[model samples]
Target: MLYIFDLGNVIVDIDFNRVLGAWSDLSRVPLASLKQSFTMGEAFCQHERGELTDEAFAEALCQQMALPLSYEQFSHGWQAIFVGLRPEVIAIMHRLREQGHRVVVLSNTNRLHTTFWPEEYPEIRGAADKIYLSQDLGMRKPEARIYQHVLQAEGFSPDETRFFDDNADNIAGAERLGIPGILVKDKTTVPDYFAKRLC
Candidate 1:
């Protein structure tokens, strides 16, 4: 069976609050205001969809949030959102591979994250048979087309494939394609969940 996993939260620990706090400190923007203004706005969405260049996205974010930080500083804070890799999840992936299950990653992430995560978490580097990113595909999760795109491109049958993601909407999207999905809540519980099912 083809087992698809989401990157953030599912396999890697990410906290938007960490980025918000860092950016707030750097930009001198109040945390609440920063959180409110620097949302998944149009520019952010465009960046995730690979429509905006990295420089343009960074500049747009600075302008919108009235951030005084240079592009490099902003990028640094942006990439700091990821805390660490979930080792248990990596172990689960390894076991799944041993069982001859095809594994891959599907994430709604942008260039900044894509650039930093692999280097920061080498444990998952080359772990997946394929990695699908929203920036590269011009599509994001919770959208039916993205799931359909992966299913078609990888020649995975919907009924035979299983998807794991932290977002309910993304899970729903996979279900819409007739793919069974597991909504991952806590990273610590993932290994046990998969063990019971896949063992």
Candidate 2:
């Protein structure tokens, strides 16, 4: 069987609030304004979809938020969104690997995250047999094409694959293609679900 995991909140801890707070402190921009212009705007979607270059995304964010920080400082705050890896999740991946299951990562993340996450959390770098990022593919979760692309690229049958994601929409997307999926409600839910299924 093939096991596909979502990076954010599934294997690693991600808190957007952390990035927002850091950016607010560094740029002295109002949190509400930052949320409105950056977090809640189309720029973020475009950035995640690889429509914007790293420099271009940072420039757009700074312009929208009136940030005073240089690009380097802004990048740091942006990368601060990642907290840490869930060790239990890594252990689960290792266990799955030992049992001869193929494990991989499918995440809707951008260049800034793709650059720093592996460095910050080496487990993520080594855990997956392959890592697919939406920014690289120009598609994100909840998109049928992205799911199709991954399944085709990996040559995995949908019926034999199991996917886990924290987002309901992403899970639904996988299910639409006949991949059985588990919605990870919290840190323990995934481990619990897998424990039951794998045992």
What TM-score fits each model?
Answer: 0.94, 0.91
Q: lDDT at 152 for candidate 2? A: 90
Worst 10 residues of 2 by lDDT: 34-43
Cα lDDT of candidate 2 equals: 0.87
lDDT digits (tens) for residues 1-199 of candidate 2: 8899999999998898888889898878888887876654677778889999888888887887788878888898988888888999998898888888899999988988778888878887687899999899999888999989988988898998999999999999999999999999899987898787664
lDDT of 1: 0.87
Query: How well is each residue in 1-199 modelled by candidate 1, as lDDT tens digits?
Result: 8889999999999998999899888878899998888767789878989999999998998888888888888988999799888888888888888888888899998988878888888878657888999999998888888999988888889997989999998899889889999998886657867767776
Taken over the whole model, the C-alpha lDDT of each candidate is: 0.87, 0.87
Off by over 4 Å in 1: none
The positional error of residue 107 in candidate 1, measured at the CA in angstroms, is 0.8
